[model samples]
Target: MPEQFIAEESRSIGHAGRRELIAWAFYDFANSGYTTVVQTTLFNTYFVGVVAGGVGGVSPGLATLLWSLSVGFANFVVMFSAPVIGAIADIKACKKRFLLWSSIGCIVSTALLAQVGPGDYKLGMVLVTVSVIMFAYGENLIAAFLPELVPEEQMGRLSGYGWGLGYVGGLLTLLLCLGYLHWAMQQGMGEAEAVPVTLLITAVTFALTAAPTFIWLRERARPLPEVSGERILAASFGRLRHTFREARRFRDLIRFLMTLAVYQSGVSTVIVLAAVYAQQVMGFDTQSLIVLIMVINVTAAVGALICGHLQDRIGSVPTLAITLAIWIAALLAAYFAEERSQMWIVGNMIGIAMGASQAVGRALVSKFSPAERAGEFLGLWGLVNRLSVIVGPLSYGLINYWSGGNHRLSLLSTLAFFALGLLLLSKVDEARGRAAANNFLACGDS
Candidate 1:
């Protein structure tokens, strides 16, 4: 009887762990529909080409600027609010609640996009901006759960698992959108009508897939001291300030984040500009660009899985350095590619490097952050990630503008960001950073 009871207990633990991991990964799967369909593939173009023009009848350039401003404004909101919200979640032990509300906000806003049509550009912009803000917050909240689910040793692989799964989700969602678009066109529906349906599909997919995460993932962290409305605000800011001070004590973490900021800027720029470069320089059509993205998605998933294992064996810093080296090479390839086929090769290389760099970077930050304050620290991580969205594209655009739209020369500027990031990253002491986090937590507790 005793032996049977022990066996049952062990089995239950294993089952729960597996369930939790799947639930966590599903959030990534769920969100990728939004990322791939709305942000990446269809809706941005739909807005610029159809809604922006029909409604306000704005110039193409102004419409493009408005779209950019909406995205930038969303990032700005998240940039300022994420840390405070994270601190509040940490203090209140309500990360899951925050995640739930944000996910719902995103879903509702995205579903409402189905209502946007010709002459509804302003409405579309508002919905997209709100959805982006909610999505960004959900991303930050979900990532804070990583350290809780797995130990430091297993974090790299698990983070990789989540990311690889995410790419798969993105790929699948993109394929679904493509199929829908094709069918809609066959039925004599134009993009304006078809695009809204895709938005609905994305909303449904996100809500359904994210259900498991809300059900299975348990909140393990304990709440800090209870506080009321004004005190909550005061305490959250105070905690954020203290986090900055504590982070200074952990210099390596600070250095690593700085390095991440630099390299990620280049990475973000490459992703944002890749299709544009391919279309303008290589003269690839929409179909070819879609095929290229699909291929990249597959390679990215493979790279994430492979590099996750590499990170466990070689350590995050080294694995990341290797990935950065790949980025440098990929950028150089892009700069010099005179033929479309060569650009295709560069895209594949970028895929591999992109997946590995992102996965390893997140795991490295998790390994270095204080266990108790993971939310606040990862919030700061979100901040840097958002800031990179601004700096990277701006820098690339400036270079392109100055050089009379010389994209090849603009690509070279990305190389500079990667090279500087690599140089700064080499200086980070991963062990020392991990130790500093542990030591600070211990001293505070004592």
Candidate 2:
């Protein structure tokens, strides 16, 4: 915590290196395949359209609500498990081991998704629940290692590369899946064939891409200090308790988390709902939806790359402020747009801002936390994210359900979240958070 130590830690960034940064970013690429193909595009649509039944056959509102709730349920399980496991990993300095176990869960869950059949609603939902839980938890664990690699100032740009790469990975996966789906359809395959085939591809993608983390990632070399058998269990619980106790003192993080909960819920809801809105509201065909998503992902990749540098130059608070304003406008446009083309325009704008918002947010958290306990803090951040996934969809579902099945009002609700977060964020001091990050890095030297 001394000034000399802080200066030393700051100086080490150039020497401490870029290999860790590359490895960290590669993890994003690996995980994004599942996020794009399995969770977002293919599986979610298949689950709701095929298993839960289509919007026409079932109450689309209810179907969506169920999917959202399922993700929420899965996230809740991760929320409880993640921080404790993270704390243990940190305490044991066994980040690599944790990554290995979590990645296995991710691969297995994706494979299980392929086995789900039509009308197997129960089985499909269960698979979705477990798959997302594993995926999210693994991402959280991987993120905990990031601050150990980069300097405080470079975090925004590094996070941007990771997020941008993730979008690129996601875009690639979606394109491949679309191509396969198109070929299958051309071969006289039905909707059933497209869904299962896509799921299988996702399973294979996760299995193959997960190898890099195990092979390339290196943790700081430290002795494996011994502890009593009973202490391990006690330490996990103690860490969890300490996290909650620590929250009272870290009021800024608590405030940030609260804002993130509301706004990110809206952000994630929009991401999940965009295709549905396009399909049902705009009356776009499947091919058009895929094309639109591809466009958005491409734009997002570009945006993330651009904004990642901007975040470093101008700082995260300012970058976040601008992104939220853009989101507010996009939500308003989605609510009022009369034609399909307009949706594409708004989607492009949303895509441009999405990666930057998330990448900067991740960097912000990393900037504010104690270096050694990054995983524990990220666990709380994940908790908010998962909890919001529950709230956003449920709210959208309820509003749509109540409005005689109109989604316009549901889309409008996002404005409230964006506005609230903007207001709260106005009060956050990014400079202080940066200083805290620097201090945390200094702590590492001790």
Q: Write the per-residue lDDT of candidate 2 for residues 1-446, one digit (tens) a residue.
A: 12443344346765443444566677788788787776556677777677776623566666767677777788778867877777777777777788887778877878777777667777877888888887877888888877787776777777788888888778877888899988988999887766677776776776676676677777773423664466876776787786677565566777788888888888877776677677768887777777888888888877777778788899888998898898898888888899988988898888887876788788888888777777778877888787777777667767877785687878877678888989988778877765655664576522
lDDT per residue (tens digit) for residues 240-287 in model 1: 988776666878888998999899988877665676667657887655
Indicate the TM-score of model 1. 0.90
Q: Which 10 successive residues of model 1 have the least lDDT summed?
A: 1-10
> Model 2: how far is 402 from its true place, Å?
3.1
Model 2 spans > 4 angstroms off: 1-18, 54-57, 221-228, 437-446
Residue 60 error, candidate 2, Å: 2.5
After superposing candidate 1 on the true structure, give the runs of residues whose Cα lies further than 4 Å from its correct spot.
1-16, 48-65, 115-122, 397-409
lDDT of each: 0.81, 0.75
